[model samples]
Target: MSAVRLISNHTLKLQPQRSSSQLFRRHASSSVAEGSFTARRGLYASLLLLSTGALAAYYFDSRAAIHRYVLTPVIRHILDAENGHKLAVRVLASGFAPRDTQSDDERLKVQLWEDELSNPIGLAAGFDKHGEAVDGLFNLGFSWVEIGSVTPKPQPGNARPRMFHLMDDTAVINRYGFPSDGHATVLARLRARFPIFYQEGSEPHASLRSNALLAVNLGKNKTSPVESADDFVSGIRAFGSYADVLVVNISSPNTPGLRALQSHALLEDLLGRVTHALDEIATSESNKSRRPKLVLKIAPDLDEAQVDDIAKAILQKSVDGVIVSNTTVRRPSTLTDANKAEAGGLSGPPLKPYSLATLRMLRARLPAAVPIIGCGGISSGADALEYAKAGATAVQIYTSFGYDGVGTCRRIKDELAEALSREGATWMETVQRASAELSLKPEDRSAHTSIAQLTKEAEELMRLVDELGERVGGADPSKDNSATESTGVLPVVSNGTERSDFVLFSMANARQWVILDRSDNAASPCIFATLAYEAIDQGAQVASSNSKGRTISGTLMYRRGQLLERIPRHAEASEKLYLDYKIKPTGDKDKKLIWAIA
Candidate 1:
């Protein structure tokens, strides 16, 4: 009877069936978990879409709007000038700086140091003293990006307020005395950058990103000796394999004695050492036979003599190139900005006249092979094209870039391309035309060539021959001398048997000519002989026969136009050296016939 009652109680409890509610509660909790998981995934997807949209907006759009309307104004107003410059660098280095995506116009393509640049526009140095933003600057569409006035050692440079903005004049004046992170740090950056794109035994300039060049502007430390090339040499050793071009920064007026390097003697020594260092670097197996192009940056403040001296030295040293100007100390009276009076190197519009004049002078002095990079007072496409017309191979901008913001290079390129289209010329065509027309030509050498100059040369040659006759008797002209035969192509014998004293101005050319002057006084019969003058390192050789009998030979020379070194040639002492003969009378009677020896 007890067992039956227990069974009945169990059955009654089972009949209530509370397990159904428990099952429902479990299902509800499971549903809630699944809904939570789905909502979280949806939130993640939404966030991802928003982030991608922001990035696309930042990167795919034109940088000009942000640079002009937002970034530039904010930076300029928020921070002081130097600090603002620092901020700009940091922003560029951060890789978020707005970049121009427009392809460079085909007309803007040009050459710089054997490399085809996408555009002729480049960014000048001083904006990135430490080489902190080379890639960043290049990303903005500059065909060439020059970095640093880097020193052998770190320096504080000039005091605060060293940079002054002449907003009214659209110019900048900075006495930044080559403040730098020094060779070690800068070199590390370069080394770090090289392996990213280049492999072992490859050329940094020709192999990695050939369309754009990375040039480092080398400067001396404040304490280093001005005459000593130790700093530049060391810089070459440190960065030669890494940089496309190494710029010798001797033109900065802020440095105590830097400008003095432009003088003949000092410049020769400096260039010699720098070139030697470069040669060594090129030959070094560790450097992969990479020959870094060497360029000298000069000042716009140079005088005529100084400019001539520099051009001659550059030719003599076989320098790769020259930057027409760094900056000017001369303040134009037209500058209305109060900061114009500040003590610093002046740049921008005021510097245009000086820089352009200097460039034209240099173009007139140097051969077309040695290119001049124009920098200064370039704000517009017209300005850059003006430089091209004035014989500049490429144009660089500093003050204009600073004043105009990130769009400077693009704007200049666009404008330049438009100008080029209007003129029906390519950038190379324009540069070549200007170079051919404006650059110094062989035919029209120096201005000092005249008949009197030839007479003076004749006298010097005679004197030298007299001296040489004393040492190594004059060379026999009839002998089978291959060198002589090769040099004298159009041999012209003397017309008269009088055997009058004649100076043979011979070049390695076959052209033949004999110039005779119809003298005003019939008895005198003065002859004016003008010859082509070829400037050479070794002065002209002098050789002559003594009035009695014996002949002498040696080199006798003089400076041409206070610039080129004259090298006189001594023809065979036995035979005369004239190709043809002619005489003409001048309009002015009794005017002494001056034979200008070029």
Candidate 2:
């Protein structure tokens, strides 16, 4: 009985010890699982934080590599060219667009008109067709943000699929045809940007940013009269108060009869009326001190005659600047993209040669006083530099910007800065030097010579004039005669008629003669005789005398052996000259210039 009880007690004790060990194992397993959960939570939190930081950095930095290598490519691949452009504008307009955080290098700094730009880089007009993303684009480091081809009335523009991407060629073809929200809508958007307590200062820019400018590109409505400047005039009057620059966009290939306005007579009328409207605006109380500059946007397809006509109109109308050129209608053989056959204006790498050639030709024709803004297929810093060396005051980009995304402006500026640093030159300095060296000299400006070769016929005529003057008992051709040295009288016979009432006057500045008829009831009262003198290299100076010995002075430009007088409005005899002769007006009220073919 003693042995049996000892065995049973041992069994019970072993059972209790086994149960306690089981509880301990369960507790150990629970602790390990809890520890693993805590470790996983920590790892997940770390990953989230790291990813958030990385995304923030990438989102803020416009120069981030991901934008160029990944995001831009993905966007280009996913969306059609038109949709992609819309989405970009939407993002920028949403104020979520990445900003260029870096400051522009000093070498890239350029002066445009009265304002100083942080850089010479500019965004072209067609990008922000409705002024929807002006500030957003400015955030991307563009010093000049041009918006709108805004017409007087709203229009839907061309059909869908109007924008095409030439991926292989790095080009874009678009025929949006000035799709806009009209002048009223765009003006409201611009005006809404003003501060609540805004006050007009002595010098306020349209951009509202000290280093930037806002240019409004004005386009006529498709249904409007293509030959009229009324639409452009209305645009100026509406937006002139708010815009820093007003661009007359008459070069879009999509618009019918739009290019016809570029013809000599039509351009003269268009520029004349627009300039007159600007003058009226400038003299108004609202725009007393500030006058928005006028810029002409031309196409790249203009021939030599068309270009010369354009230049003449620009100079005559006193336009502030020109944007050389818009998208090209000509298809280059180098374009290998499937969309190359698209019937729209082509813009991209293929446009570079046409645009650059046009820019060079225009620069040579325009004087230094008028600045030329280079546009069309300017994608790289080298392209911008090439424009600068070719006398472009500034450069604009569109297709490259579309293909490259928000980083384009920064990339181009960086490239240009690097190039300028290597050359030890600034953008403005290069442009100024090129302009001075390449621009046409005063004496060399011949209407015919600009297009065709100059004939030796002018030299022969000049010699004939000298021989005729000597035979008429005039003073020696070699002597520089002052008006005071002569009797103010010259007897000359023309067509077997002797006129004793002809008086001689020497123009002090131009060294040319002015022959005024003192006879009463003469059919042609004023005769300007171009006397060939060895010292007369400058343009002719015109003068006329009244009864009180008062003198009227003006400039006479030599155009292919013919004299075109630029009559001074301040001259006392200007009204009489216009009324008596019924001079052909240039359509501007401020212009008193008359054309005399002889």
Top TM-score hit = 2
Clashing residue pairs in candidate 2, if any?
none
lDDT of 2 by residue, 466-525 (tens): 332322223355765333122122234444454443333332323333343332211121
TM-scores for all candidates: the values are 0.69, 0.75
On residues 1-598, what C-alpha lDDT tens digit does candidate 1 reach at each position? 1122236546622334447678799999999999999999999999999878756644554344665567677877778778989988887888887677888899988887667888988889999888787777887888878889999899999998899888789888899888899999987877766657665338647225768888889999999987898999899888887788889999999999999999976786677667767777776777755678999999999889999778766764668899989899998889999888899999998899999999999998887888999998999999999999999999899888777688778888888999999999999999999999998765322432454554444343333332322332334434432332112212112342221222234321111111222222211211221222221123434333334222223443433222221222111100111211111111111232222121
- State each model's CA lDDT, in order: 0.70, 0.72
Q: Cα miss at 555, model 1 (Å)?
A: 15
lDDT of 1: 0.70
- Residue 445, model 2: Cα distance from true site in angstroms: 12
